[model samples]
Target chain A: NAGVTQTPKFRILKIGQSMTLQCAQDMNHNYMYWYRQDPGMGLKLIYYSVGAGITDKGEVPNGYNVSRSTTEDFPLRLELAAPSQTSVYFCASSLSGGDTEAFFGQGTRLTVV
Target chain B: TQLLEQSPQFLSIQEGENLTVYCNSSSVFSSLQWYRQEPGEGPVLLVTVVTGGEVKKLKRLTFQFGDARKDSSLHITAAQPGDTGLYLCAGGRNNLFFGTGTRLTVIP
Candidate 1:
């Protein structure tokens, strides 16, 4: 089913630059999320969507934005990237919001200088 | 912002050795999950515990959820090189707050 697919496996951006990390899932999941992992830190959620056109902020939502125009796509936009934004970003999706399994993409390794 | 806190951030063990890592939190959750992430890859779900004091086993790995639903523990028996990775514990449903994680290295 291709599970979850992420684009631009790696990216490098300069300070004040902007970019978007693209994510898509063919599983028809109702819930999608964007998370960043720094070294020893497991993962911090940046944003999430319960369904199309519905988004919410998570534990660490600063410096990032997301949109869910469709259930298959949830893109994270980084505006004015900073060094602190350099990390491995992952996109995940699950069938529902509770108790079900969430599938993840390989992740996009981003570096901001 | 990280509600779950894991202990012994790092651990190295010889093949066939046994070890345990813990995840603790002050907030209660409806359910908790365990995930293992290999180097250079995203995490995959290992198991989930929905009921307090629930215990679930997957191969050589044993997972236990606290009676109060605020903590969890993961134990590995006769560890192997393939078991080396980062283990994370998460709580909540929609938000899914994750722990700092425990990185394990198993050497042959």
Candidate 2:
């Protein structure tokens, strides 16, 4: 299994620009999450989905959105990107939430100028 | 939101030395796990401890969960350069919460 996969290993966006960070998992996990990590920091949840058609905001979900239309896909959208959004984003999935092993993508390094 | 705090945020040691990293939280967790991450890469799971006061060992690394279920520790013996990386501890049954992480560097 490819496990979890994220598109565009790196990207740079201008202020007010919008883009989507694509994430997909082949493990058929029920839980998918989007997290951002600043330089020398821990992961902060942006959004998460428990299952298809169910998405919820996390600690830092102000400038982002997420959609889970299929069991294998969960994409994160960045609207009106700002410089503060510059960070490394990671997509992860697990069979279920809580105490389960999560498989993570290599990460998408995003820079908003 | 539950918070997990890790101590000794940074450490550097000579090869073959031993070290321990701690993770503490005011909130209790059903389970806790340890993960190691390298530069430009995502974290990889090292181990998981669920039972209070549980201890698990893998090769030169040992992991323990606090008896109160509010803390955890990771110990590495005979550390090597390969063990040099960012170690993170996460807990929570509803959502995964991560600690700030401990950066370890082993010099040969």
Candidate 3:
């Protein structure tokens, strides 16, 4: 069973280019999150959705946006990619929020040039 | 804001040796989880501790939660090369907050 899947395992984006990091889960979970990990740093939350059509900003939400149009999909969009945006992105989902185990995807490695 | 801090940002040890990693926080949590991530991979859950002063064992790894639910520790006995990875601790109340992480390299 595919717990969580992210598309475009690796990508290189030119400055000011826009791209969408696709994330989908088959676990029927209600809680989905987007996080980015920089070298030698912990994962920082970007955006999260508690359910369909309900999204919220996280600690580091600048230069990014997210949409949860369905229960199985939570996509992150970068309107204008910058050098500072290069990082490994992970998508995670949990059965519910708080005190529950989260399942993660393989991750997408994006490099903004 | 809630913060979780992990000690010994990096560690390298010989095989068969033991090591301990710590996670501390000023805010209390309802539960704490440990995860290990290898190169080019997302973090994978190792164990979770809920109750205060709880101790849970996963094979050669022992995880303990502090009595105040604001601290936790992970001890590995007889480390192996396969145990090399970045270990992270996450505390959860209404949301999950991750620690800085400890990078462990068990040299063979």
Candidate 4:
């Protein structure tokens, strides 16, 4: 079912540039999340959506915004990219919020200069 | 912040050796899961422990959940080079919270 899919596996952005990371889940999951992983560190949440038209901030949501316009799509936007934003970004989704297993996308490697 | 602490942030061992990685927390969790991630890829779930004191085995890997649901452990017996990856432990809620990963490298 292509559990989850993320676009632009790799991206290089200059400081101050804006871009949107695309994520789509085919599993009809009610919850979707965006997380960024630094080298050797655990993942930090960026943003999450519980359902279409509902969004919430997570642990590390600075410089990022998200919108869930459809059940299958959740997109994260970087208004003004900075060097600190460089990290491996992941997208994940689960059937529900109650202890369900989450499926992840391959990941997007982002580098900001 | 509800933090999950993981020990031995990095481990390097030779093939056929045994190793254990730990994840601990003061907060109780509904469930805990272990994942393995290779370079340039997203992490994949290895096992999930729901009930307290639950023990699950996957081939040479054994996962255990603390009775209080505040900790977990993973033991790999006779490790192989293919086992090298980032081992992450996650405590489950409405959303999963991950601990600082333990990177394991099994040298051949």
Candidate 5:
């Protein structure tokens, strides 16, 4: 089913640069999320989408933006990358929000200098 | 903010040894989930405990949700090198709140 897929497994960006982290899921999930994992820390949610055209902020949503134009895609945009943004980013999806197991992507390792 | 804290941030054990990791929180959860993440990969679901005091097993791994629904424990029996990875506990309400993760390394 390909489950969840993220593009550009690894990337490095300069300060003030911008880019988009692409995520797509084939599972037909209604809930999608973007999370970043710092060293020795748990995954922190950046943004999430309940369905197409419906988005919300999560625990750590600063310095990032997200848009859900279709049911299968939710992309996170970094307008001006900063060194603090260096971390591993993961995309996940689930059939519903609560009490459901989420399927995660392989993760994208991003480094901002 | 609903936070989940994991104990024994890191563990190094020899083969065939036993180990236990904990996750605690001050707020109640409707359900809790456990996931294992290997190097260079995202976390994979291990199990989910929905009811208070519930116990579920996956082969050599045992998971128990506290009766108060605010804590959980994961125990591994006769650990093997293949068991080495980062363990994370997530509490679910309207959304899932992840714990700081317990890193386990089992040496051969």
Candidate 6:
């Protein structure tokens, strides 16, 4: 089974352009997260969803939005693509919050020009 | 407030050398995890350490959780070129907080 899947493995955007990154999981996990990794930097949490219709911000939430309408899907939206936002974005899912292993998707490499 | 910090942000060594990476935090966690990520890919889970003072070994890699559950370390013995990558340590909170990450390059 495909544990977690993300679309548009790579993308290039211009300033002020917008796009959505799609993420889906087949494991039926109740928790999903969005994170961004800068060059030689650690992954920073952007947003998280505990379950359907529940979303919360993490450390870095600016310039991004997320919605979880179904348990299997969580999409992250970039409203205004900026060069600073250019990084590798990752989608992850976990059965629950604490002390649980997270399954991660390959990731989306986005570049803002 | 970044809760986790890793040392030796960049490390380069020759094959068969030994190296250690450290992760430190002021917050106590229930568990800690280690992950390795290749270029252009998401991080992959290497191992998880639970319980204070727990130690786990996988092949030539060894992971240790501090007795107070506030820190951890990863040691690689006789490292190979395949071990070159970004190593990240995560602490178990409501969700995992990844460390600054250690970039390791093993030269052959």
TM-score, every prediction:
0.97, 0.98, 0.97, 0.97, 0.97, 0.96
Highest DockQ against the true fold, candidate: 2
True contacts kept of each: 0.60, 0.68, 0.53, 0.55, 0.62, 0.62
DockQ-based ranking: 2, 5, 6, 1, 3, 4
For model 2, residues B1-108, the per-residue Cα lDDT tens digits are 888999999999999999999999999898999999999999999999999999999999999999999999999999999999999998766567789999999999
Stretches of candidate 5 off by over 4 Å are none
Model 5 chain B: weakest 10-residue lDDT segment is B90-99
Worst lDDT run of 10 residues, candidate 1 chain B, spans B90-99
lDDT by residue for model 4 over B1-108, one digit each (tens)? 458899889999999999999999999988888989998888888988999999999999999999999999999999999999999998656667788899999999
User: For residues A1-113, what per-residue lDDT tens digits would candidate 4 score against the true structure?
Assistant: 68899998999999999999999999899999999999888888778788999998878999999999999999999999999999999999988762677789999999999
Clashes of 2: 0
Model 6: DockQ vs. true structure:
0.68
Select the stronger candidate by TM-score from 1 and 5: 5
DockQ of 2: 0.77
lDDT at position B28, candidate 1: 85
| lDDT-superior candidate, 2 or 4 | 2
- What is the interface RMSD, in angstroms, for predicted model 4? 1.5
DockQ of each: 0.67, 0.77, 0.66, 0.64, 0.70, 0.68
Question: In order of the candidates, what TM-score does chain B achieve?
Answer: 0.96, 0.98, 0.97, 0.97, 0.97, 0.97
Q: Residue B90 deviation, candidate 4, in Å?
A: 0.8
- List candidate 1 stretches off by more than 4 Å: none
lDDT of 5 by residue, A1-113 (tens): 89999998999999999999999999999999999999877898888888999998889999999999999999999999999999999999988885799999999999999
Model 2 chain B TM at 0.98
